[model samples]
Target: MPVADDIKSSWADEVELEGGALPPSTEVRENGFKIVTDYKYNEDEKKLKIVRTYKIEKRTVSKSIALRKTWKKFGESATDKPGPNPATTIASEDVYMQYVTSKEEDNKPEDESSIDKLKSLGDKSVVRCRTCGQEHWTTKCPWKDTVLIGGKLPDDKKGPAVTTGFTNAETGKPGGSKYVPPNMRDGAAKRTDSTNMARRDDTTAIRVSNLSESTTENDLEDLVKPFGPIQKLYLAKDKTTGACKGFAYIHFKFRNDAAKAIQALNGHGYDHLILNVDWSKPPTHSNQ
Candidate 1:
């Protein structure tokens, strides 16, 4: 490998220079890196442009994640060129923000009169009583003393009279200032008679016995509903286990409907047990 003197001189004169100007110098620090941003404002167009430049040190990543990063874009991103697409990606704009401190009065306790005003406003709302059908609470109704039968008051009485068991020692008359139990009050017997009369008038109730433990009110309803319109259905269940207690009461709108249900389901087999259907008797109370 012998070279001529002219070739050696030409090679020594040829210096290797960079293609473009060197990039701007970056100040590297151990605590934190610096962010350099270039801002340009165009007065004619009323526009402000910003270009942020930052450096990030390369770190080791999992091989799977690196392979995923090298995968080709698919679906909606398949036609998109490299880097952020101007049509899809938007540059963030500066937003003005403010913080407000609450006033001392806002944290203070409300005035007593304000609370009373709220109570008065609430009272102004219509509140019809369920007992008397008046503009008052059911508990404060004037006719609350009267027994409610079928969501209605008895047509025969205005209200029950509350008696004070005060007796004159010589006259033997009931005019004492002592308190008397409601059951011992005067006219108590009349109230009981009215209640019993109401119950006796309902002759469409039927009793169903030998029901399965897993039976529910829905099951009984489904069984007897086809016979007629059901007014009420009561299934007796154990309080502890919440299971059927082998009996139930169903009140139909008409006696004929109840009779039909009894005829159909009396000997019917349900849950591997025979059903016993019969007319329900009004409950009786013993003096004891």
Candidate 2:
């Protein structure tokens, strides 16, 4: 059967209240009146469609529930971080450069301030701001860049000296680098700094505490030399008397080579005992 067109979101579900109105009041109650009940029916198809109809209404929630939801999704923004650490490499632009002119001539110009010599120069040299060093060219260096292990640290190196000795740049004292007189060489044929870059193959000097009374420097070198070059192999002796102190310093030409010796022969047979091997470096405060 055809019916009234629509329904709604929330139905009032109306019913006459059981106790509220005190029964049609005393004065009107004495009279009886005709009551009309509206009945709706199906004409042809025989089914009841609009049994009854009611309207719906809605209301807002109290304050407490709205506040509870505010806290769940946003406490603070996470898109931030602290600045870079001091130990980090810094990037920037401060550079200097120099060059040589007229190399075929016996005396190359000592200075590079003149542009007249720029075309005449045999080669160009770049002074890197990052490392504070000079190179024959700027091919590899970036103009402004984050510092790198590109050059030596000041503490790791010292001003070039006019002399040389065993006090070479490690442990007990100062370091040294090969240098040539400004008067002699055609170009700087960079001298290697034995102390600055401690290559993995650099020597690991060992001072064993309990070496056998019979173990000699030659004996230790004889064992390790097979694996790598044994540089300055010797056992430490008493300062005045000259008897073996039962300990030795076996310097390898390289650090990794020394490590290999410490690994392969550390627990090997040494006459009556095994060698006690350890790496010795000048002790720092924290290492203490």
Top candidate (lDDT)? 1
Clashing pairs in 1: 166-175, 166-176
Give candidate 1 regions above 4 Å deviation: 1-186, 286-288
Residues 1-288 of candidate 2: C-alpha lDDT, one tens digit per residue: 234345422244332232223333111111333222223334663333222222232346677875663443323333222222223435568987777676766334444334336535654442433332444233434421222222344433433441232233233122222343442221111233322333322336644545677666666667777868766676877777665686776777767777777777667667777777766554354221
User: What TM-score does each of the candidates earn?
Assistant: 0.37, 0.29
In the range 78-106, model 1's lDDT, one tens digit per residue, is: 99754455568877898878877776666
